[model samples]
Target: MASKAGDDPDSLMSLCTIFCLKNLRRTMCYSEGEQNRLQLRPDVFLPGEICDRLVNEYMDLVHTDSDFEPQDGFFQLFSDPRSTRLTRLQLREDLVRDRDLEAIGKQDLMELHLTYCSRLTARGLRTLCSFRHSLLSLSLFGCSSVFFRKSGAPLAAGEDEDEEERLQRHTVDLDFSFQGFNRLRLLNLGGLRAELDVEKLLRPLPALTSLDLSSVHLPRPAFLTQWSERLASLVLYNVELTEELIHMLLQMSRLRHLDISRENQRTSKFKMTRKILSSIVQSLVDLVSLDISGHIMLDNCTVPAFEDAVGRPSIEPCKSSIYPFQELKRPLQFLGLYNTTLCNVTHIPAYKVLSFEPILRLLPQSSAPVSQHWATWALYNLVSVYCEYFTVKPSHQIRFHPKIMSFSV
Candidate 1:
């Protein structure tokens, strides 16, 4: 029995309800002249038809960006009769507060992302603990205000005295009561520099598989040891990879995605030699995404890997002193060498070589012009080299820059 086109869930979702502004640029809705004059108020409308479409069709209300910073504020946005069915919500760099979060708490949200919501404190976050059993993902990335005891938001002498007091109380609540996120699988605390007790934070999150501790202060590696068994994706970018951290990483047998990219200047040169690279390969058998970009390589000398892991032949780093090994079990899906040079990369393991998928993945969706520019160049080369067998994905079909196709021709 052939199902009708309307009966197909994929077809119906594509044809109706879900409205993604991601594919549609702001320029598509407003002219440059009108955009300049348009005051982007909280409750402002963007040409009646578009606004109507959003209200009528939205089922989940995923306004992921701060671009269309909800006309009626978050409260009114949730007040929509259709908003009762909402599950996932992502908001960034907004003046969203506890009162707004209270409204959001009413919904049975499964994935909540409140990135850089400076106005929000842990007091408001405690409201969403009711959804602890249901919620699977929560990213409070860059929302430093939640962790801090003080409000950085400039206020006159005696402005919102209650909220200031609340911030202090909630900061304490966050320390002990954050166990509500037990079912959470993905947690991103990137760029949050605060005095954090790493052990207490990870104690409740038993199900967490992907964690982004980028630019965070993870002094004790013992806290991360508990997560070694379940955690598959871990991003420790810009954090110091101490000797204990390296030893603990060697035990994470299930880890597939590891991003140890670091700042070139602040990070003392990490020695990434052939031996240490071999050790990583042998231990982390399931490792697929390895990002050791921007590090000081050794065995010879100078600048290297992940907040710069030191790999001196004379100095044994990890517990497994034995090296000159092979066997990945699987090829790495992505290898990030963003800031590394030929001089730095010497005796890296001869593991089947890298796939072009990483560069291909970067081209179409890259928000940065420089990334797109370099990715396009790399994509062309991959196409030229493997043009005989290369098959362009449908999503990547129209996104290729003109010069690459022209040059390839």
Candidate 2:
């Protein structure tokens, strides 16, 4: 018997509804697959309407996909108390290529290290600098772009236009001023040979503690006199060293560590004399460490005699008055006399020795033949032991072992 049309209408409606549902399910599956392929992580869930608003407002600056996201483990490593307040961000050679740096904004950044970043350029640096106030510490070690001009002659003195025009033309250079960092402590401009206005650069950083200008040309000695006494450490790698420069550095009475290794080179024409070096050393009454190695002048000089003479008592008459040069009252620890032609092992100074193996090898003919292999092993062990012990306490009981102390015979 055939069913009536009205009675069968409910069953027909049910069949149509099932077909529509199946299509809707397929569409939903396709949409999900597309979303997954995009590789978006679970969205950062906002707690309330207020949070949602704030997050949406700054969504572009925040939210990163899995590849761009900062690893939790890496973040945890830098979450220590020592590294927490570290406003200076160092982008090492390994991390420089990472795209994650784009996510890092300069909200509280004070310093930045872009050492050995061959790919980094002035344009990118300008962009990075725009995020923060003028960076306090800007390290561009081994970065060639920073030192040399890309094209054309160096920016001339209004050779092209008026003040407004010049300003517009060199907006990037003007904005690259270091004036914003009044509390800057350290600046490492190693390998930069640009004609930087040292006085202008330093004027902003009144609280600078350390300055490294290795392999870079600096302004006149007169300019260094203007440096603040807060400077505790200074490294001059391979630059001209004059008596005036030495005197200017002497003005920094609070300087504790000074590396004038540039003066120790064999090919260096401007060799600092024993008298000048000794005078400079004497002036730094508070100096706790000093390194002057690789220079022919120092190489030829008698190490023991030089050390003893520098440390000896001497009465000298000045233009106005006379004063006695007493032994450096501050413990002159960690002296690096490396690459010098000093042969006598017994003459080596008795401070916490880092490397005596080199000196041992150069000992007199009477001394036993030093085993090169044993010396290498001993040096490694000494460094390891010293580092371990020092890591525990940086300032106390810094001593050497007898085994490492055993010179030749």
Candidate 3:
């Protein structure tokens, strides 16, 4: 009796029958209450839950196996704006602990701006300095914690420490003794307000091209003068640009760009006069561009002198009598004469004037690689104003082209 086909106690169920029973139970238990608790529809939750569960279950298989390649799970999770903002602190902490993970090969990462990151302390920065070999740019713009706050203590008689110890204790002392980044191009230490020895920092960076010490309370020009050949661009914004500093810059024949704005603290006889400006420009024969804006003391004469110096020929006249006949062959290509009425067309050579106004109109029409918005605007305005002075006849087409002439300022 017990050995019957369907009612036998020892009889086994077929695979199809077992699968049908499991599906039936799953369908019956799939309710809206469960959907509501998970805040997702059953159709949506089912696939997502299955994917997450599978990933967790096979995590080792995916990570360890040479053939398996998983998607960027971290990027998928943190790409959302909410997730980015919420987890930034945690991410920073994790990055600090796993410093080696941030080393993404031999790419220059100079002037890193980690502003408002409270957890990024001096120790963290010191750790990050391991990348100094490839790091030429570093910008800790609003990192108040890394900056020095004056400690109200008098000098101790017995404590004589080394450069590394001094750097750790003092905010201004940047001890970069660990060498490797020989190709550092630009260093912007703005808002640090520390007393940094410019020479010490520059000594390590043999390939340094630009240095911005805006509001950094740096030492005298002598420190910079030591590495004049290596420094091509110098920004002393809101810092003091003394006569000595100007002379130092003039002596640096390789310097191409110099910004000495009102941010300079020293009040010296560094007038933007015709003779002084011309002399300064004349000294930098290799300069391709020069910017001296935001200094209210500069007058209209400064413009002509700048143009004359830039347009002057690299080769000096043999005698004073041959000066008038000396012609410039390579004039400065880019000159920033912003915020000054000194752009008097009469002072510049007729053939050497390249107005920006016409160039601006032509830029939109042309297919050249003019990318920067501010630079485009500046070119447009410059050409437009310069074109106003030139009387173009209806029969004659007015063209604003960059002038090519020898260095004869």
Candidate 4:
């Protein structure tokens, strides 16, 4: 017996509510933007009406997946108050059309995350300007084709034909504008390759405090002095670390967190020298966290002095030692040193007691020449740091170095 379209569960609104409640409840604990996968069956498409209905239902249920939970009290206690007012729409790896997003523009969306959405054109992205006033964060990670036109608005007739002609000839020179996001605070443009005019992009977004440009091949550093004072967190992962780039970054006086981990040896000249470290430490007085991992040249020559400045306990410097610099003014809380040539044991500086809690993560390099003595020293240092703040684990390889402290692996 063929069921009527009105009677079908897929078409009925009641079934939509039931299906959403069931699936969303399973993953209710995950944050709005945290769930990466949606188990939609392949070779089948949800009816357009159903899709629209689901989108609306999901937007409405942004506050809570279901009233009852295993830990109802705990869930309510930590629930976001703003979740009820603003919805977060995450559409990833989908063939989403312009109309699909245009419909979404009607709601007050706080966050819009679109990853690998190749079908969403430049025009589709521009359409989002309609709700720009309410939107707080927008992440378009790995959407390569969508771009910003240099001259954002369309050219008027009989006015600057030469400029239009040049633009037509060099369409590749186009870039995205940051006009819509007036209240945007966090933006992630990871894996986007374009020559972005930093000054122009940041001019409109004065409230923007956090930016992630990881794996995005940025053009030469320019106009960083403009918003350098406002940015609190920045990620320049795998970017070429030049002296000029460092100079540009140092201008950001209010930056509290920074990650400039150059994983690949893109160029031999890319070295984090003692001078550069000193400049960063001296300039960015508010820096609380930093990561300069994966740079081979970041050895004891620079790391020891930096550690000491930021409050690391007294540890012996390497054979090629550079030492006892001015103590760090800013209270650094976290330091990362994974896959670097720098010996973990050495260069742990003497931090001011009770001023701030510090955490140092050090994983030995695969290509490093490991010796018994070096391993023991590393182990000892790790134990000393661990015991200072945290309890030592029971299962361990304990060893006492004659010169250094006792450590366990």
Candidate closest to the true structure, highest TM-score: 1
The TM-score between candidate 4 and the true structure equals 0.57
Model 1 over residues 1-409: C-alpha lDDT tens digits?
Answer: 5558678976665554344433232322322263333222344334323333443333234444334434323244443324234566666654566666665555666787777776665556566676687788888887765554434442221123444464554333344445767789998878775566655666778798999888788777777878788999998877777777788888888999888876553455456676666677888888867876666666633333432343422111221121332244533445555445421232233222222323544544545444332454466466656644676565654223221121211
Least accurate 10 contiguous residues by lDDT in model 4: 352-361
Residues 294-349, candidate 4: write the lDDT tens digits.
56655344444554355333433232123312345533454444444432433332
Off by over 4 Å in 3: 1-119, 139-180, 194-201, 262-270, 297-329, 344-409
* lDDT leader: 1
Score candidate 2 by TM-score against the native: 0.56
Q: Each candidate's lDDT (Cα)?
A: 0.56, 0.47, 0.43, 0.54
Report the backbone clash tally of model 2.
3
Per-residue lDDT of model 3, residues 1-409, tens digit only = 5445457432333322333223422431232353322112223222322323332323333444566443322222222222122111112211121122132212233334343333334444555565576565554443433433213332221023332343345444244432566756766655554554544544566677787776556556666775577778877755656677677777887887666654221343355655556666567766665555434444444223444454433223221111221232344454443343333232332233232322334555565543332454455555466656776454534433344221111
Off by over 4 Å in 2: 1-88, 94-102, 128-138, 147-149, 152-175, 194-200, 298-326, 341-350, 353-409
Q: Model 2, range 1-409, lDDT digits (tens) per residue?
A: 5556336875654444333223422321122353332211233221333222222222222232333332222222222222223354555442343222333442345566776654443444545544445456667676544322233334323332332343333322433555556656778777663555555545666667888877666657566655646778888766677667777887888888887664235557666455665576677777766766544453233434544444322212121011121244533454544444431323333243233334445446775444332344455466556665656343433323332221221
Q: Per-prediction count of colliding residue pairs?
A: 15, 3, 37, 8
Candidate 4, residue 260: the lDDT equals: 86
RMSD of each: 11.5, 18.5, 19.3, 14.0
TM-score of each: 0.61, 0.56, 0.48, 0.57
